[model samples]
Target: MTSLDMTREALARAERESAMKSRILATVSHDIRTPLSGIAGMSHLLGQTRLTPEQANYLAGIGQSVQALSQLVDDLLDFSAIEAGRFKLHPRDDDLRQLIESVVEILAHRAHEKGIEIASWVAADVPGLLSFDPERLRQVLFNLVGNAVKFTNEGGVLVSASMVEGELEIRVRDTGPGMSVRGQERLFREFEQVGEEKSRIGGTGLGLAISRRIVLEAGGSIAVESELGVGSTFVVRVPVGQPSDFRLRQARATMLSSTHMLIIAPDGVCREALAAAVTSLGGTVRLAATPADLLASLEHAADAFTDIVVDRRLADFLSEELCKHPVFRNPATRRILLIDPETRSTTRFLGAGYDSWLVRPLRERSLVGVLQGRMKGIELRDPINDNRSNSRWTQAEGSGLDVLLAEDDPVNRLLLKTVLKKGGHRVSEVETLRDLIAAATQATGRPGAIVTDLSMPGGNGLDALSAIRDFERTNRLAEVPIIVVTGSAGSETRKAAIDAGATELFVKPADPAKLAELLASYAARRAG
Candidate 1:
């Protein structure tokens, strides 16, 4: 046989193997996630009901386990797609700082449990918005930071982003036991775990491999620098497309030009980053690491800062004292609290003379908005007098909607129905495409939103969605929000759903809380 013919045969075999692997992964993903969706859904329901402390803890553990398993499935699926050359990057303009903050926020609980701090910093020069695939970028950062947190016990993990020569560079540095020379060589290889404590620190070792593929696909490069006893830092550099408008930059500069701000954060990195951002935007900044420093600076300084941003942790120490502080009470100065997302007693803080609150790890756009007075502060209402019925934040249990749910599986259907009902929504279920189309089109009253699973028994959800869209257009009706919740994670699947007029797409085992939030937002938008 000719050499060319032999090469062709070899290529054919490889292609067949790749296709088979992708198909197997898809099957595995669906099978595992189908059950996981039920488990996660039920746990979420259990959480709402009154439970003993022990039961709550057990439920939390179950939730975490489900998340871990789902993550594993996702990792395997992503790797398979990359290997099969089916991985695609969908880049769009998004808030880079917000994305980084979200990843850090998600992992902060774990870091705090291990007595380690996890923080993020985006360079002042890095535009507030950049063109990139936010979800894919999030996945890469999550894996890198998660791995860093898992391996580190003593110090902490710091994820920082900077713009270098028009390329977006992200560095994840950890004070963990670093890799040796030999270990570094195989670090990005599939299923390769290094270090003596590899068993103790568990992972499938496909994280770096998958991350590398994602970065490379985005026309980027990822590398690591490490020493045996010191630490490891993973650097990812990717070329970004359109940044925020130059006119907006000018506006930011103009708004902040006359501003003098005070930033109080215990974390040194965060404190400096805030100062840098402010300084870059043509503002003057003062840094205080402690309450005492803040007080002293206020007392000694001639001019009062226009804005005082206090970390919620430090505010706890100040407590009632903050309300009495001269600088905090000054009408000329805005009091902004840098709050953790899990902080629930915010009403008290807001009542105690805070003008506004920024959820930490802070996003640059939010900060700019707050500082510029473009983002309005919460209205100071009497806590006792305020029933909060009229407040924008009131959604769950406050208002309900008519929902049409399409799912073939009983367990999955129950999960969706329960979640919607729990949020006070009236749900109508349909198990087949025929029923779905009939209910959506023939019904007298329109549903506020439609939640559907893509792969039904007889016909696909996409077909039903397309039909619904056609019906809407034919009848000159307002388009309903058609949210697709599917097990398929393929880019093609996502594109197809969007093409079929799906309002949004969510992978299976979607968080009930987030789903509810989405519905609330949809309602809110419509009402507005």
Candidate 2:
């Protein structure tokens, strides 16, 4: 054969192999998930039953196992999809802290079982809101943390993130067991668990391989460090654009001008992190390791501190010991508690007597928010509320109702319908443009919102959107938010949808929580 002919044959063989792998993975995914779903469903139902503590624990373990199996299947399919050139990234603006928190929470149970502590923090300079593929970023975090939890038996796992030279550097460090210099060579390669880790920690061994692919695809790099018994740290560095790429709620410039902060944290590293954040916010910081030290610092200070920041661990460990301390009781001091975002809630901390609290892996904007509010002696809110668009709806008012769903794909329609139903929304499903028009034009019992899929029969989704807008205008009706979800979101298609009046456009596999949040916001606005 000629050189060109040989190259063509090689390419053909590779294609054939990829197709076969994809088909096998697809079949296994369906077969495995069908049984796993039933197991998860029954286990969920069993969990709601009144049972002894031991039995409840057993049920919880079963649920975790099922979820682990499901995750493995998903990983396999994702790998196959990527190899087949089907994996796509849908970037959107989201809070990085919230994304990390969501992943940490999902894997916390496993860590807790091993008597491990998992804590995460972002550098102060890192923007709280940035544009990225949340789902992909989340998968990367989940794999790293899950591996950390799986291997670590003692000490703790830390998810630390920082922005360095235009890249977001994330490190997942664990104190469980480390690897050797020679063994690190095969870590990121496909199906290679390296050394004895494959036996010690049971996994399909595809997690790191998939994570590297995702990180690289997103214009990032991932690396690792390990010593035989010293545990390991995996570092992933991804370009997250410059600070201007973020939606800045508060200026990066120090807002803490002339403000004084006293940080009391049990972890020395945490103390330094807090101090650095305060310094960036244009404030001076004093560190305290104990309540006694705090009192001495307060007495010796040239001026009273504008804020007293305490780690929730330090405050609660000492119980009322700190609350009764003269420094804590001082009228001039505004108390702020630093907490792990995964395990801590604002209500819990607030009830424990902090005026306000900041989630850890502290962001500069969040630090400024807490300090700024306290400078004025106002009640402080979580950092998440600071950057997220504040929805007017309180929990009671945010309840969704009577949503009109337009989609031709039965599977997607049913899946979304069940999700909405479980979230307390009454869904009216329509497969055709006529049904959608009829539903929208109903004389009474209006839907709270309309969700439509593009490329449906009988009409273009953009046209349907325009018709809906025109109907609302002609009939003197209240504006109902329209959500467009489609597989194709070319610039022209997006512009067309927006011109016709779409509130938001989501590509396939949109986050359900986001969809619900949007719907709730519309409901609350209309009610207001």
Candidate 3:
């Protein structure tokens, strides 16, 4: 009780707290910086020149390194936020149906790659409108779904939701190596894993911990059930109504049975491609090469069309008019403006009351994702072959080959070039879609497979693929294989690239070794 005794005890406590803070910061920095360094270094290496096919693959492996590192960093940040009780919830009225669809769309590609099918079933009994934070819900679900996909080596991940006694119950089930009793008990503890195998799989092990915190904060509860070597299921239950909660009415309110899509572009090829992609997605697409034709079409079908999608160049000419027009002013109709990456100005479109902004070459998946997000009831069918139950291609050894590299980022281009070159493949580089076409046409002299980025200025990888297909149709080029590379492997983007004629899709920061193996396989196929 003495003043001296109190001061001594207080000093010790402060010192202990400071030391713990220092330790935490050091661990986080190491965890975050490791993968970031790999991403930057490998990306830089890939941009170099004169790379062999094998070397190019080594650079691809760098991307996987970055992803693993990024996940760890995110887990740490989320854990910290939860522990501080500083994590805030911004709840809004959301359509649970749409939210589940969005999560499925995001994770579909990864599941497909693993030969796993993901099916979602939302119970009709569950209320369409619920009060919750969309982003937080997405984050929580993403962690669960992502874990399901990552841990499962066979079967698939299924997400289903229903209402049970006034509570919304969302379940994520996966057929993978299941957890043990001890694993289940420690699942929600920070920096903890069930076993050695899990630690090697590269998780910071904070996903379940963060999920528990978020669910609890939202007045919800989460539980897990699993059996060894069979599968696991995670269930989240949250109450449906609270007086302060905001409710999002069903998307069916704005649903359209038929949709009209207008693609306005100066280039005929680009216009046709956009039209085709839209049509493939169950929309009636109209191509307008000029502003006059576009305007005429809009005016003629003012009431018939449910939505209007226009190129950025054409958007400028029609934005003001569309906003003031009686048809667009109606709440039922929606407008989406498409901009080329080169056009950075968003001021004009925002002023015109456009519902969304899209950038070219507008991957089909992204477009559909945006549409599905904006519209309430339009359902999107699975793009992958669900019946195909084959496992991923086995890892292969390097077979010296030639590679055609197409990318816009100077750093990424150089990095890929370096890696491929080191792997012992002859590498040629191109920056634009036009150049890619030219290179493919001239491939007879230096025949090889193509590796291209999805997004590029002055045309893109998909455009180049279309041109290559045309050349093949005319017998001007051989049936050379192509790989599409991208940053965000959204379900829509992957499906779009594949539908556009890519042989395989690789997400950014991919493993270089895997890229090399793919190239080697292409070479073997060409020889066979």
Candidate 4:
């Protein structure tokens, strides 16, 4: 055979092999990721269970390892998809403000843990709604922000967006060791790392390459500006336009429309508490304790229900069944899964099907925000009661009382429990709402007060609080004080807790001394 023919044959063979490799990697990565996600999630859930300090640390390490594995698999798949031109933009109207804020909130904790500050600013003039695929935008932003936080040591990261010539220009800037000229050239090239030295950071090195492809596919361009030993700024520019639904929604804003919500769970306490919370926000909530109950509820008001929230486990069983149902056929209705943050397995399970997942420990504000974000037509009533504001109580300590507490966040929950227990009062602790309810109800003596986190697995603290109140009302015991502990403080949440018979609402990271004083006052009142 001629040399020219042999060279052509070799080139064709190489192209075919490359294509086959991409497909193999894609399939293997996808399959591996499904199980790996479950492993990572389960590890997280295991960490939340009762463990010794050492055991807890070990579980945390396992969780981190699984997360790293998941990221590696995801990067491999993303790179393969980009190379094959399978990565495409899926654009939809998105709330830019909400999208950016959510990303920042999700990443801020990790950045802070690394001693890096992450901040975001959105120009007020930015449209409330813009045409973009939020998922792709989020993925690109995640890559940029992740790299910034990973490389930075002592300095901070800033994310901000502004309008420029009918386009939105988003920037992620980091105070980290800058890249060299060669590094910049290889940054957006496939499978290229900054340095061959083992001392540098680790990654699949395809993130920036994939990010560039995603940005370009979305009708935008991405560029980087960096200085060695100074920092780096990655910018993305995408065209901005008012969303079609935004205009129609604005026109209909004057008309009062009632939104129907469905809460699917086996526990009555969680069902009732969520119902009350939704009701407080001017939404009518339908509680369904079982799949049969949910189907029945949907039958009665198939067209009326606008949103659905189900526990992750229950959602797993119902999603396929529910999707086949006539009620869920409507594309307008939103489906959300209420998930246990510690139960990473549940997260992976829910991720397979649900529109979104609401992490357990649902504060009133977050719940309201989620609902509002989903049901754009429903106007939320302000939950805060400014008319009854008490400046004196702002700094006043909580009433002193022997309390039974149920919470999942170890640091915050333990800190609060310690402060209350040290204040010459008895304090019993449990991790889940189910345990809290069982212990509180089965106790030989009544607790002077019950303190609980609003979100917990099995059920939320709000559920426990409602159950306690219902038991007291049914048994005719003297009204026991209850305090709702939450991470977010909003008037709406406070009102909902009070309406559900809670005595007070306490935000996390609250002053220990002030909480102790409040507990003392409440204890004195009960004694009196």
Task: List the candidates' TM-scores in order.
Answer: 0.81, 0.67, 0.43, 0.45
Global local distance difference test of model 4 = 0.66
lDDT of 4 by residue, 271-381 (tens): 444564455435677778776887788788655678778776577678677758766656677777775433445446445555565654344445656666743222222
Candidate 4 regions exceeding 4 Å error are: 1-19, 195-201, 244-528
Query: lDDT of all predictions, in order shown?
Result: 0.80, 0.71, 0.66, 0.66
Using TM-score as the measure, the top candidate is: 1
Question: What TM-score would candidate 2 get against the native?
Answer: 0.67
What are the runs in model 3 whose C-alpha is more than 4 Å off? 1-60, 195-199, 240-528
Per-residue CA lDDT of model 3 for 226-317, tens digit only, reads 99988899999987663332232133222322667666555532354455445543567666666577668767764466666766666667
Clashes of each: 0, 4, 36, 19
What are the candidates' C-alpha RMSDs?
5.3, 7.1, 21.5, 24.6
Candidate 1: C-alpha lDDT? 0.80
What lDDT score goes with residue 197 in model 3? Answer: 78
Which prediction has more favorable TM-score, 1 or 4?
Answer: 1
